[model samples]
Target: MAPEMISIHGGVFRMGSDRFYPEEGPVHEVAVEPFELDATPVTVAQFAAFVDATGYVTTAERP
Candidate 1:
């Protein structure tokens, strides 16, 4: 069986950080328009299928 897609509602989400990572400084606000996102996070099984078809190897596999 294949994974299902997910739908996300339109809303304003706070982005960035006030005091987290150096690059994350200067907090900012973002507007995420209504859109459908993947219901489940990509799993190893799905990645494996993609690799099997494309022979794709990740950086970790490069040593």
Candidate 2:
């Protein structure tokens, strides 16, 4: 069975930081829209199965 997904409501919030790193500096406001997210995390076995089924190779596997 598929994992349950929950709806997230859109809202405005402050993001980033100026006190931490230079790249993450300059805190700013961010607005996000409603979205659905899975309630459960995917297992390693599941990911392996997907890779096998799709014949996908990771970057590390590349020469």
> How accurate locally, in lDDT, is each candidate?
0.84, 0.90
Candidate 1: list runs displaced more than 4 Å. 1-3, 43-63
Prediction 1 global C-alpha lDDT:
0.84
lDDT of 1 by residue, 1-63 (tens): 766778788999788897778898777889988887677798889889899999998998897
Q: Candidate 2: lDDT over CA atoms? A: 0.90
In model 2, the runs with Cα more than 4 Å from the true position are 44-63
What tens digits encode model 2's per-residue C-alpha lDDT throughout 1-63?
Answer: 877998999999999998879999679999999999888888999889989899999999989
Q: What is the C-alpha RMSD of each candidate to the true structure, in Å?
A: 4.4, 4.0
Backbone clash pairs for candidate 1 read: none
> Candidate 1: lDDT of 33?
88
